[model samples]
Target: MTTLNLPVVVSARTKWIQLFLGLVCMASISSPQYVWTLLTRPLAEKMGVGLAELQVTFSLLIILQTFFSPFQGKLIDRFGPRRLIAIGTLLSGLSWVLASQVTNLTGLYLAYGCLGGLGTGIVYVGVVGLMVRWFPQQRGLAAGAVAAGYGMGAILTTFPVANSLAAYGLEHTLWLFGAIFSLVGLLASQGLKAPLDEVTEPASRFVAQSSRQYRSGEMLRQPLFWLMFAMMAMMSTSGLMVTSQMAIFARDFGIADVVVFGMAALPLALTLDRFTNGLTRPLFGFISDRYGREKTMFIAFALEGCAMTLWLMSRDNAVLFVLLSGVVFFGWGEIFSLFPSTLTDTFGSRHATANYGWLYMSQGIGSILGGPLAALMYQYTGGWHLVFGCAIALDFITAGLALWVLQPWRRRFMQQQA
Candidate 1:
């Protein structure tokens, strides 16, 4: 493999500044997914649609966001991050602006689902790909920090969005925040630039990483990549089920309207979940940096399973329900950090953006199973018990895969590269 000998050096301060800008950009686009739950009830009432039908929008958003990532990542890789990300932020904000005026389901899907998905997808894969290259020595920490922005950004918006929905009505609220998201994201994206190959740090010895770069096509042919994809799919299903269905299930559990800790249970739980979800990415990523990726995956996945079990058992108690939701998210959100970091470690950073983009399509598969499909399951089963049970099972199964399958396979793969 040939290496570049670029003359321009990216200073340490410049790299950190890039990371900060990436985080801000990620945060700016987060509400389209994380804040969707707050809009569901109103959207449903306005459109006169069933929950299952409404959730297809969520599925579409995720499907488009993930399914097209390879193409989007390639564009970012070739054209650089600034212009594409700026355009992405604009489209994301415009989705909401357009969604505010839509009268029917198809229009809603096009505006909020297609446009929002495409826009956020660009920013997400672009920022993550940038982080892995810029911080090869701290892939976990850097990726997690930016991923945390996506997860936790909602913390800053959840309550305000909830309040806006209550005060201004859904349409006006969408317009207001949509404009804000666009402007903020556009400004943040202006500062983002890919690191020059010569300035990037080599992989740290503390973590296992491939010595040679593998193109996306080569990565796709590897059984190891497929195994990781399956694990990520299962984990994504478990987490996204909660993400897209939490409000519905909370209501079914009779806790959505219940006041706990002097606040409405649902919004409070959502707020707390955002915080933990955001915190866990960097926290677990940092751990994986030293202890190993597979080990951290086992621990976090198992924690989510345990938390889900407890959450199901204690559903009737509003206080426990709120607290447990946070725990569940804490265990689930680190996938964004761990998987990308692990993939770069295994595949090499030269093709990191496009390779990880291919891997990210797993989230789209998860969204199909977790979003509309899970909603339909609830409709058929007439309760959330079976739905929650299935998610718990997937959680444990994925946890097992992390230790028994991924750990060994990844070790061998790295040894061969060595």
Candidate 2:
């Protein structure tokens, strides 16, 4: 491409920057997961730790997301996302380097749990918020696209990072990861900043607060918001719980035969799962655009709830596989995109990122508790029956909460107020 004048480079970059930024942001966020598989055995053996001790990193990671999301959101409002993401990415690289030297669990916690988690919160907010701004017309799709990048990061880095580990060992692998983090982060961040006009415009001065411009704080006060939160949390409780334990669940329930049945198609199915999730967000967003964003959210919430309900009752691998696939593909897909768009419905365009940021933070809280809750239920009952049973209970509860949000009642209230 021929270089344009000074203004043109900036203009060209702004329009296309989200794609680049999204990729890097996702790469850094996904590193922890690869660490989950490749590093698990070596790190545990070297550090003399158990599975539970190592697993604390996951809970702590989600907990940090809860703490840092609002702060990152605020930073996006205060300073443009460029600096926040760049700095966060750099920190993550350094954390990996530091993690490489750690001989104890405490050091691992500081390196991966604290630094990795905080850095991701910063970078993820920036990339995702950038997508929201670029694709205001398709909130679900945009959400899904950003999420898909994040989820897929491991796939991209897994092989390459693993190759490095195979040659260098775990200690050296951490340093190599740090180097990748620093270089990719710095390079990727070059495209991250918004145009100056967007940066200079103060967010609050532009807020159209005539009841529609919803502030995150004010959103918390709305009964509708709580209901929406419940829907996401409840549905996610099952979807994520299953996701956290999919391989083990598959083994326990005789999933090998069913998965083997799809062996020829499994790779395609995984791609389909990711693509369907990514595409569903945008497709659902288009649906919301035509029908009504709130109603779209309600429907998505109900679908997700039902998916969990089905999973909870199924014993056959065939049924389990289908429901699990659908839940992640469409069930969570629906909510992932639906919630942000609904924020626009309730709050209008002004505070979509900030408002939605707080809403998504609810997921972090639910994620932390969901795993242990499911595990405890299994410990006592020795199967997924009780855990999935709780999912069914929450399914209706969340659906009811969703109905209160942008459904008939919320609609009636808005009409009367209007």
- Tell me, by lDDT, which candidate is best: 1
lDDT of 2 by residue, 146-262 (tens): 666665555556556657777888888888878787778777776775544333222222111124666778777877677666666676665556555544455576653365344
Off by over 4 Å in 2: 1-16, 31-50, 93-95, 158-175, 195-211, 254-279, 298-329, 413-418
lDDT of 1 by residue, 56-109 (tens): 899999999999999999999999999999999999999999999999999999
Stretches > 4 Å off in candidate 1: 1-10
Candidate 2 worst ten-residue window by lDDT: 200-209
lDDT of each: 0.93, 0.63
